[model samples]
Target: MALQEYTEFITELFESGKTHSEIATELQRIGAQSCSLMTVRRFCSDHNLQRRNFVSDESLGCEVLSAINQTGPSYGRKFMTGYLSTLGIRAGEGRVGRILREVHQPYNILRRQGARNLNPIPYHAEYMGHKLHMDQNEKLGMFGVTHVLAVDGFSSKIVANVTMPVKNNLVIYNEVYRAAVASNGMWDQIRVDHGREFFLSLYVQEKLSQHRFNTNRLPYKQTTSSKNLRVERIWPEVNTRVNYPLKRALVDLVDTDSLDMQDNNTKYCVFNLTCQVSQIGLERAVQSWNAHRIPGRGIPNTLAAGGCPQRISMELLPSAAEAARMYEDELGASLSWASAFGTDPFSSEEDRQQAEQVFLQEYPDITVLFDRAVNNDLSLFQDALLCLINATNRFA
Candidate 1:
């Protein structure tokens, strides 16, 4: 196996934006006789082959500054590094920090939660489903809503979070509880502040019992926020990423008189447009938070790892039949049509319109539901939509 024989192939892969490791893996997959990661790295280094052009330090500094301005100084080193990667700037924290220093970029020192306490309570969770810390942030009430969040005690990964008009018990059960359990599976126990919204529900317990797990809830008073640091820490990220942006947008909407007239009096508008926009913003934040790599963290950085609560515990997730039955029981009707609003099933505008029309015709009730999502109470449309499809399949 001569190195010269595959030089052109390796160069082509490199030019095509393949990393050395990727190129080596590809070669191996194609049965390259002498391909190895070390060989690829050595060849690239010897040939002066690089991922991109060698931009000046000043140019890279400008890019880093621009990213910080877009993301704000509030983002820490790891998030900034990940954000830069998203922009095709493949640099480590050391390089990123140097650029920040060179550009005089001031890093925001976030005050640690529970910092004031002389002796903070030590908490630990041995596994992903060991304990879920549940809490609600009403800071977004100015934007006419509140966010309910569930964070895993172990990896600090968010289990499930939802923005709702009112933090009602039923809404918590349906949106937050169901979401957490269905996605991450049943925790052995959940800890929450003594809010009636979470405490009043036996619904969650009943559902967990069906999975052969007796889920317990430990409620604390207002003083427990310091002790419930797992979910409490998540609020800062949510406030910066989700709440702040929406608040500014809502204010702008009000100033422009863009809000639905009927929704003006409410603390939060449930208008379809408002809900859709808010939902997208919130979900994107959640995804970003989960995907973020926590630096120097003992656990896996990405939430896709089994250690993170964001990764579903498949063993405890309900079967298709059970999920369908639960949906029918909750919504009080069998879902009859397929909806593609979130799925992006159509590629063309004409096809999208056709699909939308077909869905509206088949599920006339969706108009009512959409109206509810928009003009009145907001519901978790995607979950309900999925359940409807699952239920339909069961009947078919």
Candidate 2:
């Protein structure tokens, strides 16, 4: 019954023009072997059944080609696929790729090459001008001082480093820029420790660039990337090792604030120059620190006090007479002789110009800063202030 039934099923299907699948299913019910698939192909070939192939109409292709040419060289295979799909002509990727190549004229194949990575290319500490690092401590609703630390990585010099108020943007910006410009026309890269003050708006970049110096508004980051490291990683290291001496002078150190400033501002520095001291006494002050922080390589770490100086005038009315006297007291005494330095300076015209390049190394700023009025008398706090100025000026 099984063999007879299998033979009868195929004979009936073949006569009735049913496909081999129908014969196979009938045969399988009677436990037949799996040989119907090859039989179907062989029968089809023997009968010479004409296979149907799908092709777009030549007129349609001409229309499509015209539609394609109507547009510029912008459309590629992707665009063609989308356009064809809209017209109910779903084409394969291979066809589209081929059509795009021929119709698009000279087809271009894309290729890329990478270089063998060499040593890391170091980032420029300065942008158009110099590098400025800034940090501001929040007062935390107290009378405590807010620290603004601005250092120039190029020089390892503190441009405008001092403690003030959390809300003291004027003091920070005015002083920092002054230090930067007096020596090096405004800062280019201003790195900060992500503090409130150092974070500037994009408008600030435009505004600052409006000045003489051109500054690109980069987000002074604190990474060690050769492309754009904010240069903060090196700051703490310098603070402890090469510049360890300045740590004692500074207080309330913020780990991140140094980063905030480096991403923002550029400071003054004196490297590779014949240095001249602003005053002998000021030199003595920094030199004294050498006892604690002596230079192994001829005072490699000479530090300076106070910001860049500019002679600013004050007008006081005669009605309130003590204004002139008060100004003198605030600045302290004008040290007739220079202050103490942790080191000495070259006392020559050549040295003066060279030191002027880096305000820190060349001429020690008058730390006990006293802005004596042009016409004002230096009678009031002159003596005490001068002593204070001298003492601070002598820091190395």
Candidate 3:
């Protein structure tokens, strides 16, 4: 094929942030004739196709400051550069580092001091959907919060995550595993720690094993949490970004005697409120994680956004709702939709609805309530607790 014929293809790849050498290699891979790095570079120059760059140091500094404010100051040199690339801004690692040091000296020093010793683990997957790793985090469990996450082993992307009061098998299956399957298609193998919370999901995986793209591997594998490297690795990030702050706020409630965990109504109200707030934090963490680049590998969202190349037949994969029905059929029980919050503070569904109506009438905006709670405003917690108490008392 003529070089001119590859123009559109090269342009598309370039716009997606591929280097000239990478574009050239892709052209050769696609059977283009006489495609070379120099040829690709020349073609790009001729077509005026160039990578976007900050026009000046001052402008670059402004963009860097904006990103830091948005993503927090924990972003190191490489991550900041990669994140900027995702925003269509390209800058050298040296310049990014210099700007970061000049701007956020304290975080830079702390980052260097707090860097952990690396102990690399050998891991591999043939393609995107080859293996799925699942795990639950209970760092905030004492405060009635739990998190379940599913990560794609090949792409290092968090395929699915959910926040709940505790690790429930049905919730893991429906919200995490089945949700992942629905979004990313079926994986060749599922890996998880030997937690009973995963039993339902694993059973469903085994039942559908034959439908996997590669049937040679077992449908699921159970191992120690430590050995489930991919999913386990993500917990530190979650702890730093989501768990730690929320845990501190919840603990303050206990220390201040503002939240009575021992009381059933208080526990229910706190659990529901905390679960909502933790979910907001978890979502922000997931977005930051997926968009931030990993060294040697590209951005997780970019890599895994393209559905699995070795995707199993979608027709064979059940939707989350269908999987729930299938689980009920196999287990002879309907899945409970109650999260860690359990039932409402009221005695019956009707009472619960009435209580919610009263609560909504007083609170008016649950979003603002959760937002204030997430910002570590302890007063919001007290306000919510007081509101819930009054609402439930009216129902009683």
Judging by lDDT against the true structure, name the best candidate: 3
lDDT of each: 0.56, 0.36, 0.77
Please tell me which model should have the higher TM-score, number 1 or number 2.
1
Model 1 clash tally?
Answer: 5
Clashing pairs in 1: 144-267, 144-268, 270-374, 271-374, 272-374
lDDT agreement of model 1 with the native: 0.56
Kindly report which residue stretches of model 3 are placed more than 4 angstroms away from their true locations once superposed. Answer: 1-73, 78-96, 312-315, 318-339, 347-396
Residue-level error in angstroms, candidate 1, position 98: 3.5
Candidate 2 per-residue lDDT, tens place, 1-396, comes to: 223434555555666866656666666676676556666446544554323333454544564475353222333454445445545565554566566655545322310121222335464533224555555433221212234445555444444444432334334444444444454444454555444443221123223443424334452444323323333433332222112222221112224232121211111111111011112211222222221221231211232222222222122111112322332355462211111112233345565454344443423443221111111222221332223223233331
Give the per-residue lDDT of model 1 (tens digit) for 169-265: 5566556766766765666667777676674333334444444333343322233666777788777766664456545545554576644324322
Residue-pair clash count for candidate 2: 56
Q: Where does model 2 exceed 4 Å of error? A: 1-128, 137-143, 165-167, 199-205, 210-396
Model 3: how far residue 267 lies from native, Å: 1.7
Task: Give the worst 10-residue stretch by lDDT in candidate 3.
Answer: 369-378
Better of 1 and 3 by lDDT: 3
Ranking by lDDT: 3, 1, 2
Provide the global lDDT of candidate 3 against the true structure.
0.77
